[model samples]
Structure formats: structure tokens, C-alpha cells
Target: MTSIASTSQAPPLVLTVAGSDSGGGAGIQADLKTMLALGVHGMSVVAAVTAQNSLGVQGYWELPPEAVRAQLDSVLSDIGVHAIKTGMLASTVLVETVAEALAGCDAPVVVDPVGVSKHGDALLAPEAVDAVRSALLPVATVVTPNLFEVEQLTGVKVVDETGMREAAEAVLALGPRWALIKGGHLPGEPADLLSDGEREYRFTAPRHDNRHTHGTGCTLASAIASHLAMGDDVPAAAEKAKEYVTGAIAAGFPLGAGIGPVDHGWRQRA
Candidate 1:
């Protein structure tokens, strides 16, 4: 152990710009947990604060645009993240502010268009949808949207695997380098569709019956960011993230008499 510090390497830095979940299930908490489990240094810019638990989101208050911008500038200017993941932007102003901050960064950006929680509680405002489409998504390296969020952002309702491509196309038209349409909400198998404007890829995993998937979206997006920070391309990153989330979903466990979070440290537990 004489000079082990000289041989040690620092982990890649990944940043999450999201809301805070008081119950430690979703948002910034889940993002950091996923990043940690995936071997990355995680940083956070909390855009909003939520009074939430396993049941549902009670109320959330968005940080002022200036405060959000200050936090973003502090991290991005000094630490210089390798990748950025976004979630739960509660208002149009915060979304716009975050979009501007991300536009200046050279790192890969993972945008999780979080529209609702696992319990069907709304996380994003209706007015912020356009801001996300016009400002946030355009700057994204990969946009991850669940079925309902896909419909919310792109107006493409994916009822089956056949509709996933359409949904990906709609999101691609918004200008992200890639779009990942998450099919976890669809019945039967859990599938995710990823696409650039020209090529398409589909990842399917056996559906798990566990209901404690409260943080899947946040976890998946953070995992993608972590992979990207570790030098994987967008398609490769999404594929790996899909694999990790599938395992986490299978390992989900109940908490507080309601839905619980996916186990971010499932690999260690296994």
C-alpha cells in the first residue's frame, strides 16, 4: 500500500439535473445511486423539491431560474462533467434554463422526459412540454421517454412494438442524436426502441412482475449517462443501460406499503 494512491484512477464524472425526492426513491437520489452503482462520480443540480413518498408526489416547488443556472454553472464550469442526465424539470422556466446550460456543454446529454411518477403523479407541467421539445430535446445526445411520456412529448402513442419506431422517429425529429422509446409500460415483454434519424435498434427483456419499480426512469437515464461518461457511444450506452435496468426491475422490492424503488446495487446483492 506504499504508493497505491498514485495508481488509483478517479471515476468519470456524471451530472444529474433533476428534482429531489424526499423519500429517496426517485429524481436526484435515484440518479446518484445509479451512477454510484455503475462506477461514476455523480453530481446533482436540484431543479425542484418534492414532498413525495412511495404512494405519489404530493407537491413540488421549482427552483428559480437564476438559482438553477447558478448551480449548473458552478458544477459545469469547475468540475466539467463527462455526461449529463436530466429529469423532473417541473416548469417551463427551469426547463429553458437547463436547456441553455446544456447547450453550452460538450458532454453527452441524457434527457429523461419525466412526465409522471410510477404512481401516476404528474412531475412535469403541461406548459413545460413545449420547452422540453424545443429547447431541451434539441440539445440531447439521447432522449429517454416512457410510453406516456413519449405521447406527452412527441404525441406518438405506442400501443405495440410496431409503434415504437414511429415514436422514435417523432422524438428524433426534435433533434436529439438518438431517441430511446421505453416500452416498459407496454404489456407482454419489456422492450425499448432506440434510433438515430437513419438507423434503429430494439432491446427486449423478459417482463418482470415486481411492482416496485418506482425509480426505473431516473435509474435508466443515469445509467446511460454513466456509460456515456465511460466512453460508450449513444447506441451502446442505451443498450447497456437497458440491460442494467432490466435486472434492477427484476430485483425491485416493496417499501412503505406501496411501490418501492428498483435496487440500484442489485449486482452487489446478487
Candidate 2:
């Protein structure tokens, strides 16, 4: 009998399609860091580039649609991402390209409908909002949006905790099987409302009294993707991700003259 060689397998791959933050506070940097911290292999596709920092974004330029599509194919064809997370697709073409590519990929997708940076800079174009709704969101396994994003997508104002239901309902209507409306932007305790159209779950956390919460959204979405790659269910992944982001916020640090990014490595340091 001839002996055969054993092949070593690679870890599960998670891909993030987003912008580049020069400051490394949010966007691609935050996504990769969060994925790594959660013990998942992370990949990237640059959709846009921005001169950004703690203060704000100075300028931005989106990549050509063909380039974006090519990058997606290059990765999905070879490395085979286990989960996909998207953020800051600045134009309608890029959004459409991602949607078309991911529509057939069999994997959980965590969609962070990022409309703005942490410092209130406009990252998404008005024309692209429609694309995000019609193209990307429908294919999302879990759509994670904060108060502003909820309003942008659904035309609903999230004034308080009670409004999370309406926001989630509207988000589910956009075709995502699950919607996680982050309530951290709401007053009172830090909590999030998740709905699968049939069921709803509340993830509560003690609000950290820290201003260093720049990358919380990106971190949460990446964490959820990581857990999904590790085989956690939607509800479990969302809950665990919320807990992780809370801890990260609690341990957040100020890096520049303005609000800073959350500490993605808080758990390791502890």
C-alpha cells in the first residue's frame, strides 16, 4: 500500500469590502482588526480611499466598478471567503458590483450600511442609497445599522428604544432575513434589537461613559462575521458581537485630537 500525504487546511476566510481609513480608526482597518481579534482570517477589497483621522474625512475617491468587480472575483475564486462583510461602498456601481458577485456565494454576509464616518463625514453618496437598498441589503444575511442608517434606509426616526421595532421591521422589508438595529445611538442603556421577521431578541449592555467609540459599528459587524465563520447562529452571533463591542468600547482609547477608535484588542490585553 502506498502512503498518501496529509494536506493541511487553511482557516475560514472572511472578506471585508470597504474604504481605507488613513488613520486606521474605522473602515477596512477596523474590520480586519475585529476579524483577527475574533480568530478569523480576514481579507479586503478596497472600494474607496479617504484622507481621514480622528477629526474627520478630508477627501474620498471611489474605485472604478470594473476594478471592484475584478477584486471580488480574484478573492472569491481563490481564497474562498467563508463570510463577507461590507462597508462604505461610496457609489452605486461598487454596491451593484458587490451585490452581483455575492448574490451567488453561499456564505453568511454581515452588512454594515455605513452612511457616515465616526466624525459625521458623509461616506455614501445620495445616489448610492438606492443601490444599497435594492442590491446589497436584499442579499445580506444580517444587516447591522444604527439609528442614522435606519432612518436613511427606512425613513423612520429612531427617537427612543421603542422605535427600534419599527426600524427593524422596515429593515427586514428590505429583504434581509435578519435585521439588527443597534440601539447604542439611543438614550438610556446600551442595547440592540434584532428581528428575523418572525422572532425578535434584545441584546443589552451597560453604556460605557467613554467618548472613544469610533469603530464600534465596524467592529460589531466584523465580530458577527467572525462568529458566523465559526458556525454561530444569527442570534447568538449578534448577541456575542454586541457583548464584544461593549467590552471594546469600555476599553477604547483616544488616539488624536478628536474621538478615537475602540480597542479591538481589549480582550487580549485583559
Candidate 3:
């Protein structure tokens, strides 16, 4: 019998395609960190560059479409990602290219249709909204959008569980296989709903008084992608991700003058 030692390799590789966060709180930085913390190999393709921090996003510049496509081809042809999470792709051209590039790939995708930064600055461009809706969402395995993003994408406001149910349906109608509607902006306990156009799940956590709840959406999407790459199903991934983000929020740290980011290395430091 052959030992097969020549065929062995490490765990699955997870890729994060998004923007650069100079502050390292969210975007590619946070995604990579979350993947590392979860014991997975992390890779990144920066689609845009942002001078961002806990205070706010100061400025941004989208990468050329050809550059984005070249990066995607390079990664997909060689590294062969197990799962991919897309964050701030800033423009319609980049979004369309990313959607097309991942169209034939077999890996699952967690789409965090990020609109505004943790500090309330717009991340995606006006022309990109249509691209995200028509191109990207259809390709995503699981699309995670917060309340504002839900409204931005579907024109539905999630004020409560009932509203969330409606909002989830509206989001699912946009073409994703599954929709995870984050309800953190709603008053009261931290709540979110995950739906598959058939079954609906509610994830709720005790509202923490901590004002340091930045990078949460990015963290949750990355956690989900990591779990999926580790072989968890959509519901299972959602459960694990919810648990991870809950702990992250509970252990979130203050970094600047305004809202802080979720501590991706919380478990490591503890």
C-alpha cells in the first residue's frame, strides 16, 4: 500500500475579495484575521483601497477592472479556494467582473453586500448597487445584508421579527439562494434572520451595552465563510457564525474616538 504522503495538504483555503482597511478593523484585514483565528488559510484580493479607521472612512479608490479580473484569475487558477467572502467591491465594473469570475467556481460564497462603513461612510458606489443586485447576488451562496443594506437592496425595513421575515423574503427575491438579514440596527436585543426561501431562522443575542460593535458585519460573513470551508451546511454555518459574532461583540474592544471594531483575536488573547 502507498503511504500517500506526497498527496497530503493543509486545510481548505478561504479567499476574501474586498477592500483594504488601513485601520485593519474591517474589509480584507478583518476577513483574513477571522479566517486565521478560525484555523484556516486566508487569502485576499484587494478590489479597492480605503483610508479608513475607527473614526471613519476618509477616502477610497477602486482598482481598475482589468486588475481585479487578473487577480481573480490568478487566485482561482492556482490557490483554488474552498470558500470565498466578498466585501467592499466599490464599483459596478468590479462587482460584475467578480461575479463572472466566480460563476464557474465550485466554492461557496458569503456575500456581505457592504454599503456603509462601520463609521457610517458609503463604501459602494452609486452605479455599483445595480451590479450587486443583478450580478453578484445571483452568484452568492449566502448573502448577508444588514438592515440598512436590506432597505437599500429591497426597500424593506426590518423593525421586528415580522418585518424581518418580510425583509428576508424580499432579499431572497433578489436571487441569492440564502439571505442573512442582520437586525443589529433595530432597537433592543441583537437579532438577525437567516432564510432560504423555505425555512427561516432567527438568531438573537443579548444586547450588549458596549458601543464598540464595529466590523461586526464583516466579521460575521468571514466567520460564515470559514465555517462553510470547514464543511458546515448553511444553517450550521449560520449558527456557528452567529455564536462567533456574539462572542466577538461581547469581547469587542475600543480602538479610537468613535465606535470600535469586533476583536477577531479575542479567543487567542484569552
On the 0 to 100 scale, the lDDT of residue 10 in model 2 is 70
Displacement of the residue 10 alpha carbon in candidate 1, Å: 1.9
**Across residues 1-270, which tens digit of lDDT does each residue of candidate 3 receive?**
867556767887999999999988889988998999898999988899999778999999999989988988898998799899999999888999999998989999999999998777999987789999999999999999998999999888777767988888998998999999888888888788899999988888888788888788888999999999999999999989998888888898888787888888888877
How well is each residue in 155-192 modelled by candidate 1, as lDDT tens digits?
A: 78888888998898999999999998888778888888
lDDT of 1 at 21: 96
Model 3 residue 63 CA deviation in Å? 0.8
Q: Where's the lowest-lDDT run of ten residues in candidate 1?
A: 1-10
Q: List the residue pairs that clash in candidate 1.
A: none
TM accuracy, model 1: 0.96
Q: What's model 3's TM-score?
A: 0.95
State in Å the error of residue 177, model 2. 0.5
| Whole-model Cα lDDT of every candidate shown, in order | 0.92, 0.92, 0.90
Lowest-sum lDDT 10-residue window in model 3: 1-10
For every model shown, what is its TM-score relative to the native structure? 0.96, 0.96, 0.95
Query: Candidate 1 or 3, higher lDDT?
Result: 1
